[model samples]
Target: MTKTKKPEFRPNDFVVYPAHGVGKILSIEEQVIAGMSLELFVISFEKDKMTLRVPTNRATEIGMRSLSSPDVVMKALETLKGKARVKRAMWSRRAQEYEQKINSGDLMAIAEVVRDLHRADDQREQSYSERQLYEAALERLTREVAAVSGVDEAGAQKKVDEVLVGRAA
Candidate 1:
């Protein structure tokens, strides 16, 4: 077989894992297991202080993907400015849906959760569950926004918050 090429993403490239959000590709190397050589992509999630190794062939199957393009990032940000679209279902049911969206690793879905769960200062307070889900979505969004926009998490958060406030206003 031909020597492994550069692969989809080179070392130091940023990637998004569906369940884990963003992680950096530290390196790609072959490991021996069960007397067979297996190629893996070593990834690091700095914010979570975690490292993962996924089989090179299964990276896409596992939802490992390159970071969103700037245009896509802009679309995700614009998603935040949309009006909240809360379903009329029960709280438990709605919570499940929001969790699915957040874990989907799709920026637009995460943005929807943020917009729906957001509570303007004058609005009624959110329940504990709502608050937790909202924060998770916000954090996930902030990380991606920061990576794509070349800003720190705090800076990205400010931009997101500004958009939310403008929408609320």
Candidate 2:
């Protein structure tokens, strides 16, 4: 049988794992398990202080991806500037949808959640659950924005806040 090539991610590269936010590739290791050789990508998440090992073959299937391009990052930031589109559905349903978007590792979807859940100074405060989801989405989006834009996390957050402020004005 011909062996397939492994995924192209390398050490020191920033990647997004759908359920997690941004992580840096720590190393690639080969191991023998069940008498079969397996290649794994060891990733470290600074925010969570967690390390994860993903099989090379499963990286793409599991939605592990490189940082978004500058163009895509810009688009996501633009998404933040758009008006929020909160639905009239029940809170539970909206929360579920928001959770999915945040975990999908799609920058724009996370931005949408952040935009919809963000409350301006003049607007009504968000419910506890709303605030939780908003913070989760914001964290995910900001991490990616930081990685793609080559800025620190705080700077990325400030940029997002600036965009939201402009939108609110």
What 10-residue stretch in candidate 1 is worst by lDDT? 1-10
lDDT tens string, model 1, 1-169?
7554445877899998888898899999999989989889999999999999998978877677888888987888888888889889999999999999988888889888998899899999999999999999999888999998899999999999888888844
Best by TM-score: 2
Local distance difference test values of all predictions, in order: 0.88, 0.92
What C-alpha lDDT does candidate 1 achieve relative to the native structure? 0.88
Candidate 1 Cα misplacement greater than 4 A, ranges: 1-7
TM-score of each: 0.92, 0.95
Clashes of each: 0, 0
